[model samples]
Target: MARNFIRETLAKENETFLRRMEIPNKDSWSPENGPTSVRRHPFCSSLKMFLVALSFAYFSKALSGSYMKSTITQLERRFDIPSYLIGVIDGSFEIGNLLVIAFVSYFGAKLHRPKIIALGCLLMSLGTFLIALPHFIIGRYKFETSVRSSANSTNNLTLCPTSVLVGNHSSTLSSTGCENESRLSMWIYVLLGNILRGIGETPVQPLGISYIDDHALEDNAAFYIGCVQTISVIGPVFGYLLGSLCAKIYVDIGFVNMESISITPGDARWVGAWWLGYLIAGLITLISAVPFWFFPKSLPVPEGRLAKCSPERTSFIKDSPGLDHKYQADEQFSFVRLAKEFLPTLRSLLGNPVYVLYLCVTVIQFNSLIGMVTYKPKYIEQHYGQSASKANFLMGVINIPAVALGMFSGGVLMKKLKLSIMGAAKFALGTSLLGYFLSLFFFAMGCENAKVAGITVSYEGMESLSHQNSTLFVKCNAHCECSKTEWDPVCGENGLTYVSPCLAGCRMSRGSGVDTVFEQCNCVAGGNLTAYVGHCRHRESCQRVFPYFLALCVITSFIISLGGTPGYMLLIRCIRPQLKSLALGFHTLTTRTLAGIPAPIYFGAIIDTACLKWGHKKCGGKGACRIYNTTAYRIAYLGLTLGLRTASFFLCALGLVVLQRHIKRQENGTLSNGNTGHTVAELQALRKEETHNSHSDQSPRTSDYDPERETRL
Candidate 1:
């Protein structure tokens, strides 16, 4: 009887275990099953989606801009529009974006984020289509003109102006008139197109950032934002490539050669070729809209029930509620209130020494980068005598490695060193600035020495060396040694035929009584005037100027890149998870507001002024004129460098102070102090809890426990 009782009890225990297992745990299950699993995590998948969307939008926008960039100068020439005015027109898109971002960010928290993103995408597509209309008309006109020109040439005698006879009037009809009509149509279309593009792009910046903010965790917000920035950087490169390809196609199709019987100069051909590239760019923008349709319509958030009381009302409750309460409270927080709250938070942040210091550093770094982007090409073209396209290509190529290494190495170094996020930021900013400075130095040195000798010493000058000169010119030829007759015979006889006369003459004349003549020649070659005692004063000035300029470039690059890293890192690290997205949005907003709107236009004005003063003949005026003629660019660079440096200095100081203050506060036990060593572990635990709650659809009534206050002594 006892053995039978034991078996029945064991069976009852087994049944209880099976029943518990069979009951579904709703908390752990995702709302959407299958492929959506990959996208369920807001911390990862939503951020990735936002990045991809931004990448597409930015790429298309930049490409459209590139097309305009390549063609705008030609348009100015054809239509007699001021280049600066064209620049303003070009900047309209950025202006629109700025306005849109400000409005969206202010109101974004209240709106359905997916709907906002969709609206942005729709606008972008519509704008792209509108922008393309002008180019398309222009393209068609050119095509028609080419056909007509071919027909006219084939029947030259019958189509002659003096000839009264024509076999078929339709066949002999002038297509040039149609081409003109198309050109007129293009002018009208371009204005409407730009307006549409501006409107489309307006909501993009804020909406995209807000979406990411809505979805991503605070700790990882910076990383995701960085990814967004990385994707953004790619836009310009793609735009350039696409524009170039379009231009090439136009050239191949003979659309660029549809001119009257008058002989077209090579420069004119080049101008036409460039314009054709722009037209192609617009078409590409129009085509980019096709991809938007495939974008996911909406993203799912974590499932949870709303709290009984609003977050404002919950302030009456002294004790912190459970996870469920906090979740509901967060959900009920009004976006407007959040935006208003941001101002105070920002002000507090600004007031904090550490935060201020970081901000200063970041501003400097950003400004330096912007300055480099704006003027580096011009510097190369002017100081190095490189073509604009070549200069742009080189700048882009060099940056690929530099930026990649900077970002990756900066992150690694930060992690390895266990630097505070702010510290890591500062270090990165400093390093990048240093790198920029070095690059600038090299660039400047290259520019100065490019023509000093036959040998190319700088990137700008090195590029000037043709294949013909590379083989024919000896190393000694660079020092103008071939012109020194006195030591040429001796050097050549000694198997040092390429040696400079200054060196050989100095060595040979040293032993002889003819030192004075050789010394005079050497002085002349070195830019020293030994003719008079005081004349040597000018020599030092000449020798030092270029080196100083090069040094400035180094300093500027270093300061900018260095200062920028800290703020960028801070944005990644310190902000609360829920607030990080908004912080990042603000960061982007500031950058775009300050830099994006003015940079291109400012550079364009510089180019125009330079061209007008220097004469187009020397700087390819009939085409896009280079900004090499004036010191305005340098002045601008200097101003930016100084501003950034000042800001960095302040930010660094602020950060240090804030950090020190926080340390003091912790030591004094004025605030709840958690074990610093266990911060990471606690964060991980919190994340796990959040994950559990999200999947289970648990209520927000979980008890509130402060990890910092719960540590065992």
Candidate 2:
């Protein structure tokens, strides 16, 4: 009976609060009184239309990000660069975001949001197209090979000196300056393109979310966002699938005689059609941009819902002179005004201890997340001995889908439970800890290192090789005319890996290119003195472990992503409603700068240290690291990730305690001031109005906690 009385009292309080906060329909909202556009199309005002455009925007950006992850190794091989260089390229996007995100997040509210978003999308499309430009302009992709054949594989005629002995077409050999090339850093285009993409993506999240929150039903906001996220998740799946398809095709398939290529997709030095996925993704991005151009600055709010905020007063703002610097709705755009007030507002926000604690957790979590994601596919390929094509396919079809489902499920749980700020924080904390715990098993799930001559195993297979033993000189190949730096791997029939025929002490080689085989290979054991072209296949033990690894990945992805939505919503609830945009923008800016930008570079650099065999560049500098010490790679990759996240959890626990205290103080302050009502800003007021709905919908349960007793505002 006491519980029932308390519930009734809070219900009455909430009902009274909602009635006072409600806006007058005639005075606050109407298309007739709003800012008139050049073309006031009805579709621009439709919430459904804007939602569609926003969803597409989300899809396009995610597709590009995930696709880049899938193609990291391919890009490394194609550019003849090391892992660290690719990490730099990955970090370039964050650099672009850091440049324009603050201004866009703050000032963009004063402008046409949809049109600005459309412009950003166009920039992304152009950037995506630009990333593929190197492939077209770089001439034919000449993968490094050391072979000599008399006839072509595709033409049965000598096409080039390196052609295989089975072809249908023949072209005379033509040598270019490629052999003596020096300025091999053609990856600059991909970097700039990624930077443009980052700049384009900057406005989408803050602006788009703010816009939706402005006009959508307060109760449905989280659910709607969840739906959009679920749709957006589809992009990565397609991206990975697209990446997989492209990786199977040879880099210069149609342009060159593919039959004469000595390496398979399984070969460490192989470069796939990594550029093609970008072109297709860009085209999709261009299409996504089209719908946004037609959307208006603001849409008319539905009945019972509060009207949208005026453009002059942004949803996110910087307060100067005082904690509350109120702006008139008719104030003009002024750089002088914003410049004067920016720092004080920033300082005031940073002063919130709870927000600071949350920031610590986010920055640390993102560091781990970014580092793992940036090198995850490479980790799979190098550790599991999977091909690039297979790794991408698995990531796309299995891992990403799990994440998508988890994200959607998280949002649904929030809406269904109507979790308060405290509730959301607890839920996020639990899921994260659980996921981290489960991920601990990945360290144990390791594949044995590939057997490479002079690297992991001896050339004659008589003894094991150590890290100190790098030179491929044995009793059999000691007198062979071979350069230590020359690395064109060949698979010997004696189940041993050889550096090359020259290093294998082979006097003569039969056929050329793809059809090439070295006979009388002195390095091979007595039974069969023959060696085929390209790297040897992985052992059966490695292949058997792949299925279990993939299953674990799917489960881990789902559990980790389950926390994503709750964590996001918790962030929204923790900040002042008016400063939502600024808080989100600041969070993204700091996280991207501190974590996203540096994570990949450092992760790749560490992984680079584990390289057992480094591919050669055209000008003879260190190219891509072809083989990695699997044990070392695993330790570097997972250790850093797990360590960062584990440390972040301490912050998460602290943040939870801090949040509880903040809520208590905030409630006390509200009670002391007797401020039972929200201000007359439509969007902000509606959030308060929904407080009654959020509480009353809850079922009475015997518990240690009671939200009704604490909600003073």
Candidate 3:
């Protein structure tokens, strides 16, 4: 009886092991074997469905982020703050991103990622709405002016040329007398709202990309990433366009007459309808969240797809379906285990010299990108003398679309050529070098600076400038009661921008608001007396350079972005496959922490040093800059951008060399097997399986990083 019982126990134990281990269907799957049935998960998505959902989510988040980027200048004008202050506000988003990204990227894999992502989307939408909240809460905007158009009309009437003038106006200077008014400083609301927006944006990329990487077919991964990136980049096109449209709308909108606004969008003092874009972006983000909450935490493996790992090693591969058990089974999470693994995993990643170098290259590159983008619009307005509206329109219509095309083409090239990791690195390096070479030409495309009296040119309008820094007062207008801090600019017919009607020695003026024409301006040269209420537009030479600059911008953007996909793939494939989410997270965290938060601030500070004229706050102290020394501004902005890019090229070269050597070593050891040369051990098994299955009914698609699909050298 005892012998029989022991034999029965041994038989039951064998049955259990066979059930758990995916005992290979020798008849169904072997090198010489015939076609066999394969199991698929019920909850798995079709490629089409995954693309649609992923694209929409990326578009929504990018739209909101880009909108904020487009409106920085507007915010500075509206809040009466310096460029550096606005930079701090812009960097708030990076702060929020830094706080939660590491934890979320590390822990999200074990949780219900879809729900977490939905929650993040909801927060982002809420934050956007809150950013717009200040517009409604604050009182009607009360701009300071040298001409009080509301109550003093008689002085203006006396100096009027009835032929050019129509409305009753005023010339008596007025101040809002906002003495020490701390209670109504609503800029704080805007700052907090932006911070909230930053927090909300944390999960969109790290979680979303990881989710796609986890479930999408290995062959389609890079292309899908490119598609998602393309859509996200395209989102900024509409964002800049939206910024352009809203800038034309008066900041007060329905509350004030458009005709009554003394400043046009081209005016330095002008504040665009910044809040409107935020509102629209918020609504879109809200809509983006709805699809995520319903998406399953994980998808089932697709049918007839060859598992990368063997059936016997199913337990070793979390993502592979080597066994028949449902994906939902064996669900578990432990914070203790997460804590235990964190340091060891982190150490392992840092030990990889290739990843560290890639991280440095990306960080430097991002710093240049963020700083350049942050200041590009301002540079255009100050250097090219384009309006904020025109600058945004050019960015939207030209620059962003070029980036989308470049990104998509990169993906297509990778797919068509089936580039190995070494090949992709080489491609990325070549494009980066070419792009850097093209960008240096921008230094030659400089436009003549604005001909402002006492700054770029002498008040007497001499071509020879004695000093960059000059006093606002000259003999002709020195006796007039002028405030050096005031920024109520007027354009004389002689093509000089006056500080104000007061500084112009115009004791009288005609018309109201933008129509307010200062007549008999005492400071005019060549006896030209009339001046309009706006800065003199830049010289005609500037108009010709504008198109050339746009062309260069388009070409440069395309070439640089062409390398974006290949570079991203290099970052992914260098690390162990299991740490993809963590690798991505750490990279984001490191870049954002070291680069994103500081780049804008330092750029703004350097730009601030080039300020020629500054506006004043009614309460006290310096506010926004009225004018910049275009020469200094151009040199500082473009020089910094190009220098960073040049430095990145060196790093890129070194990284490529390191990667090539590493691959060569792996190849010598017979470890590297994939077309992309990923050194994972499972590649050989999968490759062996695929080679023998060529005679089967269905075959897998050829892609970049696998052995069965060798790349064309």
Candidate 4:
């Protein structure tokens, strides 16, 4: 009875307040008058259409990004670049974003958003196409091999020479110089293209999300964003699947004869048809831009909702300490004036303890996320002894779909429960903590190191080899004169990988291509043992572990993704509606600069340290790592990932505490203002409008917390 009396009193006072403010009453407004008065093309103005367009934009960009990650190893091999160099190329995308994201976020919000997104999509397409440019411009790929087999030669190939061949050093130098120059050129093009892609992607997330939240039914905003994110996750699935398919094909397929190729897809030296996927992805991105061109700069607020701010001007600015800037909708645009307000606006955003703490958690977590995702496929290939094609296939068909489902489920959970900011923080924190604990299991899932003579195990299999005294020379192969740098591995019957058939002291070889078999291997423990092309297959125990590792990955992916939507909501909800775009942009800027740009580079450099075998470049010098110390690799990768996540949870707890205090302060402030009547009245007005529009959609719960009201803090 007391609650009813207070509600009725607030309702009456809200009616009077509405009339005094001259805000249109529900009966006075329709599709034909006031804010919803502007006539629009039905298809172009519908929120559904905008959602579809934005989702596709998300899909296109995600596809490109994932495709880039999926091709990391291929790129490393193709350019003969080290992992650290590849890391730089990978980070170039973030570098591009850092260049333009701030301006695009703050100013682009005031301009035609859809058109700007269209422009961004076009740039992304161009960039995708540019990444593939090297394949066309560069000559046919010349893979390094110690073997010099020819179809016209005798069936049995000769053994290694008794003495090492001393070729013209100057000619070798010139050839290496030319090869390095070519490699440098290819990677530079990739770097620039990726940066362009990053720049192009800057406006898509902030602008599209802010636009949707602004026009969407407030209750449905999280669901819509979730749908977009869910669809976007599908992009990576296709991207990696495309990568899987391409990885099986020879990189120079059309230009090179299949019969002449000696390497199989599983060979460490193999370069896949990585450029083909880029062409297909670029075309898709170009098409995604079309719908954006037709979308309007703004859409009408859903029928039942009023503007997020009050008629007297939002309290976010007036209530904020040291923040005194205001821009009216009718005010003329001024670059200099807006520029002057940028710092103040930024200060206002940073001043929020909740936002700052939230940013800290996200930034720390992203470092681990980016590094892990970027190197996961590589890890699978190296650690589990799986081929690149197989690794990509598993990730595409298994892990990505789980993430998509989790994101969608997160949205559904939010809507069904009507989670407030505090609820969201709790939910996100719970999911993340659970995922982190589950991921600790990965460290135990590592496979034993590949048994390579003079590397992991001794040539005789009688002792372990240490890194300090590692040498390819042994009594059995002392006369073979093998090149230590060569990485054309052959599997001995004794279950060991030799750097090359020459290093295995094979006297002769038969057949050609992948079918080649070296005979009379003197280095084998027993006399006249045979060896086959390609590295030895992984142990049965390792094979069994790989599937279990992948299964755990799928589960962990789903659990981590379950927090994605709520966490995103927490970000937007904590900021004032007017500053949503700038806040999101700044958030992205911080993450890209601190996380995306450095994570991959440092991770790559660290991973490089575990390299047991480095592939030789055509001219010499260290190239991409072919094999890793699996124990060290696993420990390093999982340790860093979990370490960062562990650190973030500390901040997550702090952020939640800060958020609770902020909410309590706002609650007290609402009661003390004597305008609690105005706040309740606004809610009453919105509720009455929702009641009238009940047939159009499910009504939002009256008790659901309004983030806009909390904006005053």
Candidate 5:
């Protein structure tokens, strides 16, 4: 009763507040008058569209990167699979993604974006469910013995120098051998699941961009795109945090100590509880799809026009004064057109030496950033001898701040320097590469010392005390030394032997020093010390690398964000009003398709190979393994850094050259591709008209078509 009364009172207060604010109730509103009258409601239709886009973005972010990391790590630990094979699995996600993107870009324009998004969401959920099923089966039976025996056999059965496990074990094992069955079956399922997810998620990228392009004005496109990308960053951050939290919870719950039915007392549990997190993520993804049913059916396409009035005046003229106009509506929204269109754009983009250079630089920068992000945690665990949870936490702690600062700085530099989109991208890429190098240096040093310090400090105090006590007695009491010969020290000593006391004291002091030095040196020499320090140092490096890496990621994102801005401005300042949407759409389709397809596979391959080599450190000869592991990681980092730097330089050069050309063309009062001055001026006039018409409720009539559109289309 009390709870109900409180709720009733709060509801009444809320109603009173709304009344005071003159908030219009949605039920009493009409759509024809627009959303202004019911300002409190905003545009439900647009809001729904935005939310749908957000959901897809979130899932894509989670599934593409963070999920890959989690799944690969799980596979490496549970199945003892080689890192190279794991790389293949990781790369497969991208392969699947690329193929799907191609197909979607061809067919998606005909399909409703909402339905496409929904389908993708469903498929992702299914994939996650299938991938996780085998674990459940294995967990249920508690089959400790069979798994242990098979693992032992596999360890004994080395097939090649690569340590690849490639036998048909299913034939030899009984149905009840759940451990082996689960291990083998789960991987197969996971691979299949990832492939399905890749295909499902493909349509999401293009469709999402289309949706944003459809609703947002051309001038604001880039800003909105940036907002989307910013949201994307959240997915990984959340995934990493959740994954780490789950791991900690598992450890705290003593899940790590539960022995397999057949293993030794200290054996780890076969089925980890951390998997629950994956299941939960899938469920959340599914739930996110619910709002798609309510998305608006269509949006008003934007039109271009020009005003005869001055900049401050609102009155407009229908056509440019004293100019023959030629313009037409060119819809490039069809899926078939997008697919067919991409090849030409891709060719053109590739042919542009500047663009090609930028692409290469971007790829390399992304590779290094991704490689470090994916493996830093594992590196910390292996090198610094830290737990997975602690390593991950340390990674988060270091990266969050570094990335935040890098992102802020990148934004500031772009704004202050008045960089064009490409210039900004180059600056971001270069800065990120520098960060990667600095992180690598710190990581290497930290790893070396962390191991040396942790172990030596732990053992040094006890050893030092032992030496001190031995030395103190030798210096203070001569009778104590005489007791060694006669048992009775005071009565049977025949007086204290002071003759050799000085020598004994000197020897003890020298011995103590030698012992301390030996212990310190010995601890440092063992590569295990590397493991402890490596974890923290690697984490710190990753954190340091985050901003630059984030900046690099956002560079492409920023380009995508600014998608409609250039074309819209070109239309308003120079192009036919009727061609605005069509031109903007064409540009958007070109850039997004080109950028999105290769990212998944390219990054996946780098991460996979790095992981494989990192895992191999566990198998090599004892003395050589740590060195091999450390060297392998160093090589990986070097590859990433060099690749990024090369890319950065290229992008910077290309952007500078292109912008210079664009500016020169503007100054000459001539159009590229040799259009006439009259035609160009008329086009610019139409764009001004379209911008004015867009802000008002007036609809554009079909009779406004001009001849220039025919030639362009």
Candidate 6:
């Protein structure tokens, strides 16, 4: 009787194990079968569904991030802060990423990845809403200008009145004072919000990409990543287009009377509705989280798609004896066990020479890409003489679409050519080199600096103002009692910009708002003593050069984007499959901490040195720059971008050398192993099983083959 009881216990244990391992057929799955039922749901089980959901998540994050970049200038002006200060705000996002990426990428990968991703998306949504909070909390934007009082009021009768004409022009200056009496730096809110955004965005890329790579067919992984990346770029197009639209609208559109506002969107003082886009982006991100919650942590490999792991793609280091314990049911996980493994795992990851070198290359390259992209819109406005709206529109409508197409094409080429790891590295290197060459032409395409009298040129327009002790109080405007603090610029007919109508020695003004024209200006050189209410238009040659520059930019963007997928594939394939998530996380952490955070700050600091005209804050300090020395700005901007790219190229060459040697070693090991008949027979058997499984109607599920598949590879 005791023997029979033992047999029954053994039989029951065997039955339970089989039940735990079984993958339910479609007809057997139902809503009543507990939590596993959710995983078995048709839509939730599909790789395609996950792909679509992941793509939208990528799009939502990219849209918000790019929108922040698009509004850099507007933020600078609105906050009454310098460019360097604004750069700090831009870097805050990276700071947020630095805080959580390591833990999320490593530990989170072991949990319900989709649920963790959902939580992250919710955090991102909150952060985006926070970014928009300042606009609503702060009083309406009040741009710094000399003509603060109404144009219809008698106080505006003498915009450039001399002390003799109006007792003192200082008296004519509006005394409403700064609306921000407390001198609060409202941009602090934006900084905090951006940091939160960074934290939230941390999981989306590394986790999402690694998840897709983990589940999809090996051959189709690159294409899936490509589709996600391509779709993500489309988000930027919408983001920049949204930026352009917001830039055209006044910052205080519904709150203020349109007729009272003197500045046009072209003015340096103009602050667009930069806050609106964040709200829209936040809503979209929130919606993206909902789909993820229903998705299973893992999915079955697509039907009829055999597993294909290239020999070189195998891990250089052997797996730990019982590392598989970490991937078991969530209830079985132990904090002590994970903690002990963390350092060793990290050391193993860093020990790989290829991964280390790739990090170096990517860090330097991202430094260049981030800095250039952050300021490209500002560069267009400052260098090419395009309005903020126009610059954003061009990037949205022209540049981004090319990038999307190139990313998709790169994936298609990878699949079609069946590029080996080395071939992919070579392909990426070639495209990067070609793109670097194409980018060199941008150095020659800059327009001449705006001829601001007493700033860039003397009042007589004979020569540039001396750099030392340069002052706006020239002989022509000496009689006028201009404050010298205000930056309300006006353009003279002689193709020169006056710092303000008051500084231009203008004694009268006509219409109200943006249409107001200052007449009888004493400083104007020609007989026509009239100055318009804006900066001077660029010369025809400069205008023609802009189109050519844009055309080159589009081509270069496409070429550079062609390398993205191949490079990303290299990053994943070089490491052990077990380390993919952690490697990605560490890479992101390193790039964001070393590259993303500092590039903008340092780049902005350098760019600040090129400022020709700095605006004033009523609270008393240097504010946003009104104009830049186009020559200096162009050199500083393009020089940094190209110099970094050049450094990365050298690094890339070294990495390829290391990778080639490693590949040879892997090939040699495989060849030696293949000579053994037993090993050859085992590989043949595994391949046969894979083929049969793919072709057979009654094949076992993908999970059933994982161990054997890894052994075969």
> What digit string (tens of lDDT, one per residue) describes model 4 on residues 1-713?
23554555554445433332233434334433333333333422478988998999999999899899999999999887888889999999989988998788778987999999999999999999999999998778877554445555543565665744433453466486676555455888899999999999999998998888766766888789868867887889988999999999999988766766778887888999999999999999999999999876766534344444454332221222221132332134346656777898889889889899989999999999999999999999888887889989988999888988898899889989999999999999999999998998898887887788888888987777767767899888888766677788889999998888878889887776667778889887664999888888857888898889988999999999999999999999887676787788678779989999999999999889888888766666778888888898998888888999999988988888889998787666667655564443354444554554463356555555343232222
List the global CA lDDT of all models.
Answer: 0.44, 0.75, 0.74, 0.80, 0.43, 0.79
Residue pairs in collision within model 3: none
**Backbone clash pairs in model 3 (N, Cα, C under 3 Å; residues 3+ apart or in different chains), count:** 0
| C-alpha lDDT (0 to 100) for residue 166 of candidate 2 | 21
Q: List per-candidate RMSD values in Å.
A: 17.9, 10.6, 10.0, 9.6, 17.9, 9.1
User: Model 1: runs farther than 4 Å from truth?
Assistant: 1-83, 106-118, 128-199, 202-233, 244-253, 256-269, 272-350, 356-365, 439-566, 572-582, 606-609, 612-713
Decoy 5 TM-score against native: 0.56
**Tens-digit lDDT string for candidate 6 (141-243):** 8765544446565435767555575544343443345443655578888999999998898888878887887666667888899789778878999999989
Q: Model 3 off-target regions past 4 Å?
A: 1-53, 148-176, 209-227, 295-338, 463-469, 526-528, 671-713
Q: List, residue by residue over 128-174, the lDDT tens digit for candidate 3.
A: 89888888876577665655456346454433123222221222122
Q: What's the TM-score of each model vs. the native?
A: 0.54, 0.80, 0.80, 0.82, 0.56, 0.81
Global lDDT of model 5: 0.43
The C-alpha local distance difference test score for the whole of candidate 3 amounts to 0.74
Candidate 2 lDDT for residue 614: 83
Local accuracy of candidate 1 as per-residue lDDT tens digits, 1-713 = 23544445544443332222221222332334312333444524544755776666666666565455544534443333445556566656666676666676666545555555556656655655565444444433221111122322321221112222431342344343433443342444455556566666665556666556544555556676777767666666655454434433333245444343211211121223444544455455445444444444434432221123234322322122224443346445545556667787676445545444544455555555554455554454455443345444543444433554455555565667778754665575466446544544442343222122222211122344332343323432234322211111111221121113332222111111111112222222332212110001112333455446544543443343433444466765654454466566666667666655565566556455534112121111233331232244445444454555556655655665676565465444422334454343345555565665565465544454333222210
Cα RMSD, model 4: 9.6
- Which candidate leads in lDDT? 4
Clashes of each: 33, 11, 0, 0, 34, 0
Which window of ten consecutive residues has the lowest lDDT sum in model 1? 529-538
Give candidate 6's TM-score: 0.81
505, model 4: CA deviation in Å? 0.5
